[model samples]
Target: MHSTIFSLLVLKVSSGSAMKLRSRFQPEAVGSYRRLLCSLAASTHSVEESSMKSTITKKSIKSEILRSKSPTRSPIAVLQDWIKSGHKVTISELRFISLQLQKSKRYHHALEIMKWMEAQKGFQISSADHATRIELILKVQGLTEAEEYFSQIRGTANQKAASLPLLHGYVKERAVEKAESLMMKLNELGLLVSPHPFNEMMKLYMATSQYDKVPAVIMQMKQNRIPTNILSFNLWMNACGEVSGVAAVEAIYREIMNNGNVEVGWSTLCTLANVYVKAGLVEKAVLVLKNAEKKLNTSKHLGYFFLITMYVSINNKEGVIRVWEACKSVSGRMTCGNYMCMLSCLVKLGDLVEAEKVFVEWESNCKNYDVRVSNVLLAAYVRNGLMEKAEAFHVYVLEKGGCPNYKTWEILMEGWVRSQDMEKAIDAMKKSFAMMKGCHWRPSEAILMSIVEYYEKHGNFQHANHLIRMIHHFGLASLPLYKVLLRMHINAQRPAFNILKMMVKDKIEMNGETSACFSSLCKRESARE
Candidate 1:
């Protein structure tokens, strides 16, 4: 069926302009194709692949793990492998694969997939599909780069597709003004940008702690005649809860229930339960949680997941296991999001043993070896000050040909720095920078400060100066950096006048305090020299 649902597109040049026609595939054909992909994915993986751990030979274990783990394979690498092999690849297959990578948060590979698709023949992109590609750009290149990309939309892309997702990106970053501007554009274009973006705007307000502004967004939605869903109420309740406390949240819940304009979903019930718990109404909270669980629609995998996390919030282990096992029985295979929620719940409860078990199960079943899952456990270990465990897992990941992302390295270094293990902290810091080579990863301010502080605390001014020099070489200048370098020259009793000249060359203005300090320090250094 996958082989049968080929999307055929014919590109035409009219008036020396390229025109795109949407590829058509029947609903039944798409359903069949999805089924085929599922079956193929299931068949390619064996249930007992890693189960025979101790009994397997070293060579066999390496072979099996390399084939199954694939933790380091980029999306482009997958395509390149196919292309180099001269394997026939369909546009639909590439599209599906790109979507999978995107969902997995492998944006680098996903973008490469889209670029590859763009260059291929008969790869038609509709406005709808193009919307997703724009989101891919936002994820891969970040907000500033994505803005540049949106500014330069060409070809058959319905520009609105790019703009709408950019609005969502702005909301994600809590850029209220940008979100408002983009929303206005959507309204002007009459593009029918769905309620999801509005909901996101409310979320942004909540994140920024602008609780008072939330109601204004809701009022705007109503004035525009956009229907508000239960989630809108849930976020609205969160805002009300934050500002006016439990009493306000309770009153709002009652008002919403009595008004009857919106359907009271299970999430609404959970919100009430949360507020009840906050109010110390344990019996009422329990009753509402029971009602929420009772309202679970078994067909939807998300409801069960929500219930599990809710139970976790209440620290009800029995309820968590109950919902988890039941969901697994029905959903067949657990998604990474589900596992992320479950693992995070366990971590929040401080049940490291249970978290480790879930992580093992996740690793055994996970495709692409998503490092995020490992990072979750790493975060827990680092949070608990269990640096040994974190280092063990970090080494294990590297040995398996997997690279830890920037956050992973930061966590490890932060832990080492906390323990005042400067050697290990520097090692971790170097590894983080090493991993960033030819990648978009940037050194975070916190990590940079930790290294700088450690070096300064130990009177290693020369090393700190070298670090600042590297930062300047990267075209990044911080205000306090010049002061540190100046101090370093004085400490080393070196040619302080040369550093003063370098500062002048870099156009760092000398305030009175800086000038006096530099003049005094340079005289002392010259005397010592």
Candidate 2:
């Protein structure tokens, strides 16, 4: 029993000592642990110390830690260690460090690091992004610095890529004068400005309405022996339409024809047509469309829309119908706006029969479309004085789950008023207002004015007065609208005296224009009373 107790005591003491030794040698306590172990190991003969064994274990742990190259150290920590250890950073490693700094948008620090790299010698980092970053950083900070850097590229053997983005950046900033100067410098540098930059320069000059520069740019093509294709001619002709008359546009067209190797394209003809359209020469617009068709050997729908729009602008109903028929023949899919344009034109011209045919053909052909198309078709019907057909068409549209918008209702109501169907017009106007109100869109002053005019035209002064009051209530009355109201009352032969008195009471100024004509009439009425 005594021997067992001695053994147990010895084992418990050793275990406790081992635990304390482990706690001391933890990585956090490595310095303390090393010092204690070094001292103990030096006193190897001490009776209470197992110094030699502990020393061996601590040396093993130190070796293991030293062998493990961990990545968890902070950048500052690694840098500090490198400085303390007097380790030299290699060129490749320094480049990577610069890249890391650049990625963080620390360009100034990156430049300093790069300068350090250059000072270290035998290090050449000439990647595109590296060069671009230096230029971009300068460009962002100071334009003069960027320009200086750009000028240095001629002397540097960096293969002339520096001018490309500099030119592009200038163009993007719309620094046209600066870009033109850069273009001259780049051309003088004997670096062939790439096609993309060439196109950009062309667009910049074109946008500024510099038609003179157009020919000059094209002349550069000739001097540089750059091929002048159909696109080049088209660009010039399009530019001419801005400052030059039709004659100048035709001269460019003739110039394209004179250039035997390059033929005029459909796009060129389209531009000519657009120029004529702007000049309000409808026949010329049609002729251009026809000529393009002959040259291209196809009637493109784009040309058709342009021709139709031109016809509408000139109020050429026959031309519109011709274009509409042409559009219908060419079939894959068409925009509803295109068809609506034709329908609206036919309605405005009072061609009810042809308009009906168009709607029928549209419904028969197009399988899917929005409700607005049907609404437009309804408006077209009403505008042509086809009330019976318009009502039937409205029913057809509703059956297809299509809701008519306020414009459609307004058109039908106007048609009713024109036909002297005052009761129906009033009812339809109320229904339209209710629908607009439901959808959180209010009726415009124009719609209400139309209602008031309709009532006055029918000699229902009381109804007209009610509508004028409603206009005020709905907040639809503006200065111009108020003038329109005063005129309507005067034309209806109603007593404008009371309204004029009210205007004076409200302190609304009656200018010379209003008083010049109505003032004498008001004075005569007062004298009679």
Model 1: per-residue Cα lDDT over 221-255, one tens digit each: 66666777666777767666555566777777887
Count of clashes, each model: 0, 0
Give lDDT per model, in order: 0.65, 0.58
**Model 2 whole-model lDDT (C-alpha atoms):** 0.58
Which pairs clash inside model 1?
Answer: none
TM-score of candidate 1 to 2 decimals:
0.57
Highest TM-score, which number? 1
Per-residue C-alpha lDDT of model 2 across residues 1-529, encoded as one tens digit per residue: 0111111211211111110011110111223222432343234223222342344343332222233345343343444455577654444454445445555665655555555555555655453423454444453465566677555543433435455556555655668878777666556656553343454565566555444555556656666666765656666666566556678889988988888888765557777777787777868887776676555324446656655655666677877776667666675667777667667777677776786787777777676745667777676666657788877877878887676677667777777777767678788787776675556566656556666666656677676666655655555555444555566666664456655654554556677766753665576567779
